[model samples]
Target: MRQRVVVRHSPVHGRGVFALKALEAGERILEYKGELIAWKVAVRQHRKQGVSGHTWFFGLTDGRVIDGGQRGNSARWLNHSCEANCEAIEIDDRVFIHALAAIAPGEELFLDYQLITDEPADDEIRLGYACRCGAPGCRGTMLAASDS
Candidate 1:
């Protein structure tokens, strides 16, 4: 993958990464940077009407909250898959992902967005995007733990 950006047509993920170049296993894909807000504040701001969802909340270096929903980097754009190839972790409040195994150059990097969360909040909901992570016996709906 390139230093800044990597482009590939992912077979597993409908036109994703396609060998942007031979990438090593456990390589750094991208970074998500922004403020980190407390759970209370994040829930308040993100608690909008229907379909509007959020990813994760983090405590920032500048003493602010960075909600992956409102302000996040490329990692935020990465889609979710049940059979994921990547992972998300928080070290000292900084969130990141590491390849679980060797990812081929052209393979689309995938991570289960749910890995960071056990279950969605009561009011948290999904609009349309269904879960097609290609994982075995996947629950068709991506939105789980819905209040409505």
Candidate 2:
């Protein structure tokens, strides 16, 4: 089968996934693959290793996270966008990327990444999850709105 996507240096961030062919809306593009681990362990690894900026961690509804850094695929390169073209749908313990709208060839894939955190969305926390998607109505941060 022909390739569906490619990983390359991205202007929005470091690396990104780009569609190699036209994709229809609702098409299953790729699965966000990686090793499963608890959020606590991931947090420890992050702090102990001092991993900053870009991360390949995808959170699951079951409280576990997929550490894409361990065994990730091209989907890990999908950057964040306020106006995203794709959405991450979690089924069971696995997550899959689906096109939200028709995507043209060479267009970069993006996920909203409504990252939620227990800490207050203070300036420092917002800066940590700062978004560079450059969408017209960018929210500046990748975090989801708090129920405040």
lDDT, candidate 1, 29-64, per-residue tens: 666566666645654554552233434444343434
Residue ranges of candidate 1 with Cα displaced over 4 Å: 1-4, 7-19, 40-49, 52-66, 69-71, 115-120, 123-130, 137-148
Q: How well does candidate 1 score on lDDT at residue 2?
A: 48
User: Model 2, range 43-89, lDDT digits (tens) per residue?
Assistant: 55655544255767787877688888888888888898999999999
**What lDDT does candidate 1 reach at residue 148?**
44
Best by lDDT: 2
What is the TM-score of each predicted model, taking all chains together?
0.59, 0.87
Worst 10 residues of 2 by lDDT: 44-53
